[model samples]
Target chain A: EPEVTQTPSHQVTQMGQEVILRCVPISNHLYFYWYRQILGQKVEFLVSFYNNEISEKSEIFDDQFSVERPDGSNFTLKIRSTKLEDSAMYFCASSEGLAGTYEQYFGPGTRLTVT
Target chain B: ELKVEQNPLFLSMQEGKNYTIYCNYSTTSDRLYWYRQDPGKSLESLFVLLSNGAVKQEGRLMASLDTKARLSTLHITAAVHDLSATYFCAVVNAGNMLTFGGGTRLMVKP
Candidate 1:
């Protein structure tokens, strides 16, 4: 089965530094999303992207956060001026159809550690 | 706001036993999903319930949705050790944003 894949399975960055998490969603999938989970916490939605634009975003997705599909298969999330609270596992997912009945397939995730 | 709640956050059962996980969502939604996650692993899709009274089964797991009640249940007919994992029920609101339940941690002891 084709699957979503992410790069830099693990990352460590210092506070106030910028970090980029990359994902390659399944080819042929249209909608893409980013979610994060603080250690031991429920996964939280960050943002959804389609047609090179953001469809929806949560409060957590503030100005410091940005997403880009620079190429056909690459979806990336960049967090600027990271804080200690930014440490979490960032997941990238994609769905084939509309959001209403969409079934998103998620990547393994990228664990980010901020010190 | 959309919120998904799962009951009995923790479950322990003996092999070959049975149990169920309940999910209740605040607000209206007809699209629901069930996913399994092992320790430190990514989500594994289990089922997608799209309408009222929709039922889907795979292996020893069955999931049903009731849009009227905004509730869904994941029933384990015969729990096995390999089935132990954190199961989460997520609901997509009319806005189509997916919000996950608190999660139920199941442990099937052999």
Candidate 2:
């Protein structure tokens, strides 16, 4: 049972700082995604990656956010000039195929705290 | 736009009780998924409903999908404390991205 793995279980940063969350998706997965959950709120989608490029992104994924595979196993999400509202649990998910019928496996998540 | 709606946003039950949570979506997609999240934790995969009339069971929980009706249900039998968590159902459109429901918070007491 291969699982999605995220690093830096907890991250604390000051406002205006740049932060990167890392993930290692399942070995055979082709589609990758990023989502965030504000405390006590429903999880929100950020962006999805396939074919080494962004397939789709939510409005929340603005100029301030970017994602990259960078390497074969690592998927990274970078937030430029973090804000207080950016503090949330960031999750990484990967699936065997593209959207529609694919089932995604989610990572344990990285808790990002901005002060 | 695809919207996943779940009813009974909050549920509280005692041990040995049976309950069902309902999830509805507005679309024609056939792929649906259920996930569980405990407080201060990440989402855990529960069930994947691939098509109409698909039913899968695990332990004390069973999930069924009715694609024609654009609905899914997760039923728990003899619920226990361990089953207490926030359950969410997500609809996967053809794009492969998932639109998750608001979630149903369940509290099972002993």
Candidate 3:
């Protein structure tokens, strides 16, 4: 079956550096989302993207975070000026239809490590 | 705000036993999903319960949702060692945002 895929399975960056996590959603999927799971913590929603715009975002998604679907299949999340607390596993997901209509498929996730 | 809660975060059972994981959400939602995650792995979709009295079963796992009660359940039957994993239930609220519950980690000892 088709699945969401992410690049740079592991990312290591300095505290003040910028990092971009990339994802390639399923070709026919429309809605995309980003979520993060801190070590030993529950997975938290970050943002949702549809029609090249953000549909919803959580308080955790601050100014430092931005998402882009630069191309048809590529979705990316960028974080500027990362903090130590930013270390977590970032996951990308995509759905063929809206949340209530279809199930979302999740990628393996990119482990972000800030030092 | 939407809040999802799961009970008995950790469970250990012997192979061939049976158990259930409960998920409760704070608000009204018709769509609920169950996912499984192995250690250091990605989340895998297991079942989607879209309406009240919705039930879906696969292999040794079964899931059901109650929209009126805002509750969803994942029941394991004749569990095996391979069924051990962290299971999460997420409710899709307005704006198509999914609120996730604290996952239940199941360890089936053979």
Who wins the DockQ comparison? Answer: 3
Model 3's lDDT to the true fold?
0.93
Candidate 2: residue A17 lDDT (0-100): 100
Query: What lDDT is reached at residue B59 by model 1?
Result: 91
Chain A TM-score across all models, in listed order: 0.97, 0.97, 0.97
Which of candidates 1 and 2 is the stronger one according to lDDT? Answer: 2
RMSD of each: 1.1, 1.3, 1.0
Model 3, residue pairs in steric clash: none
Q: Model 3, B4-108: lDDT tens per residue? A: 999889999999999999999999987899999999899988998988999999999999998888899999999999999999999988877888999999999
DockQ of each: 0.62, 0.66, 0.76
State model 2's lDDT. Answer: 0.93
| lDDT score, candidate 1, position B84 | 91
Q: Compared with the true structure, what per-residue lDDT tens digits does model 2 show for residues A8-111?
A: 89999999999999999999999999999998888889999999999999999999999999989999999999999999999999999874556888999999
lDDT of 1 by residue, A1-115 (tens): 9999998999999999999999999999998999998988788889999899999999999999999999887999999899999999999999987755679999999999999
Residue-pair clashes per prediction, in order, are 0, 2, 0
Q: lDDT per residue, candidate 3, A1-115, as tens digits? A: 7889998999999999999999999999899999999987789999999999999999999999999989887999999899999999999999888845688889999999999
